[model samples]
Target: MTIRPIVRYPDPRLALPAQPVTVFDDALRDLARDLLETMHAAPGIGITASHIGVSLRVVVLDLDPIDGARTYVNPEIIWASPEMIVHQEGSVSMPGVSDEVRRHARVRISYHDVDGNSHPEESEGLRAVCHQHEIDQLNGLFWIQRLSRLKRERLIKRFEKISRG
Candidate 1:
């Protein structure tokens, strides 16, 4: 598996919604492997196909090293709890910037595995946070947009400063 280059923030491609994965084939499996490699190399808990400029609805997450990586193709959040939870979120595309993001405390998502088999699972806490974050990426909504205008502006400024220095 190759570690693909992650598309950085402010890239117009990152703002566009991802296309759903229709075929479950070797290419899809390879892309999933590549995503896992790239996410692991980024040392990030989660990542999506859109993060690497691939507009496919795929996400890779590894919140627990002991359990290894998990791949999701055409993931869709079918249910979300009314209760909300806040978790510090970051993206491989954004690199150094991170902020708290509020989302449903629990979520049930339906997605396909590497072989295209459908699976639906419920998640909470950090797992739920990762799903929400990656799903937002798939929807073309950067995590920064979840912040207030003032906070978003400040964070962008800080990111620019860090990027320059």
Candidate 2:
């Protein structure tokens, strides 16, 4: 298992949008596997390729082992419920900081598997939150951007402190 290095917050790459994946081959499979290992090493439940400085539209989520690991390529939220729910969210890039993020209670997502098969998925609860969060990261919208200005500033300060000592 290869655990790739994670790109930390404030890295310009984290703010850049990733390109869509066009090839479905051994490389793509390797990338997916490396992403899973990197996420496990980071100890995060969800992670995107951008988190590891790879500008590809890929995400891995392992909320529970029973569900196994899931990889989404070029994932997009095709539909979202009007109802909203708040959940604590953070990123592998910006570890040690988290805040309540309000998102759709349910979401319908369209994406491709690592093998290049297209599929639509419906998710709720924490799964829904993760789908939105990782998709946003793929779109270059970091999780903290969803926070209030005051909260974001405070959180950044806290992260800075953590990084320093």
Candidate 3:
């Protein structure tokens, strides 16, 4: 396992759609492991494959307190509760700032494991929100997109200033 470099914002790849994994090969498995390592090293709960310049529909999340990490390939949100909850969220790619946004309180996701076996699971609380956030990344969506127009503008400026430093 290795820590992969995170791609920062304003990178065109962040807006590019990710490709679906085709083969459950060794390389794919290694990428998932590396992603887990990278996420842990960042001390972040979630990471998307596009964040490392790999345009693949893969995401790794570690919301467990015991260092248990889960990798999802070709992840999709199968169901989301209508009830909404707002949480303060931030990203490693854009540090030192966070925003409050509303997201479904529960969700069910389906994805293939490293061995190519399909699985679906229900998640709630931070785990649910984190998974939804990462899945959004796979679809070229960022949390900032959920912000109001004014807030999004301010965040972009803040990130721009950070980038210039």
Candidate 4:
């Protein structure tokens, strides 16, 4: 597994939607492994193929390191709880910036495993937040969009300042 360079904020590729995985082969597995390595190196709990400039519907998440990482191919949020919760969120792509964003407290997602096997999982708490965050990236919805216009602008300005330092 290799630690791929993360595509930073303002990169046009991050804004583009990912293509669904059509072949679940060794290459797909390798990409998932690389994503996991990259996310761990970034010290982030979740990451997407888009983060590495690959336009593929893949996500890797490991909220609990002891439990190992989970890979999702062609992931889609199938249901969400009516109850919402606000969690501070950031991204590997947009390093050094974070803001609290409201999201479903619980979510049910349909995704495929590395071998193209179908899987459905329900997640809550940090896991739910991470899944929603990553799925947004897969759909080309950067986490900043979840923030209000004012908040997003401020965060980006702060990020720019940090980038220059």
Query: Higher-lDDT candidate among 3 and 4?
Result: 4
> Mind giving the per-residue lDDT tens digits that candidate 1 earns over 28-112?
9999899989988997889899999999999999878698889998889999999999988877888898998899999999999
Q: What is the lDDT of candidate 1?
A: 0.90
Better of 1 and 2 by TM-score: 2
Best first by lDDT, ranked: 2, 4, 1, 3
Task: Please give the ranking of all candidate structures by TM-score, highest first, separated by commas.
Answer: 2, 4, 1, 3
lDDT of 4 by residue, 108-165 (tens): 9999999999999999999999999999998989999999999999999999999999
Off by over 4 Å in 3: none
Per-candidate Cα lDDT values, in order, are 0.90, 0.96, 0.88, 0.94
> Clashes per prediction?
0, 0, 0, 0
TM-score of each: 0.97, 0.99, 0.94, 0.98
Candidate 3 C-alpha error for residue 16, in Å: 1.1
Cα misplacement distance, residue 105 of candidate 3 (Å): 0.6
Q: Is candidate 1 or candidate 2 better by lDDT?
A: 2
Candidate 3 lDDT tens digits, 1-165: 889899877688888889999999999999999988887787688898898899999998887778588889999999999999998887767766679878999999999999999999899999889988888889998778899999889988987887778
The TM-score of predicted model 4 comes to 0.98
Colliding pairs, model 1: none
Write down the RMSD of all candidates, one decimal each.
0.8, 0.6, 1.3, 0.7
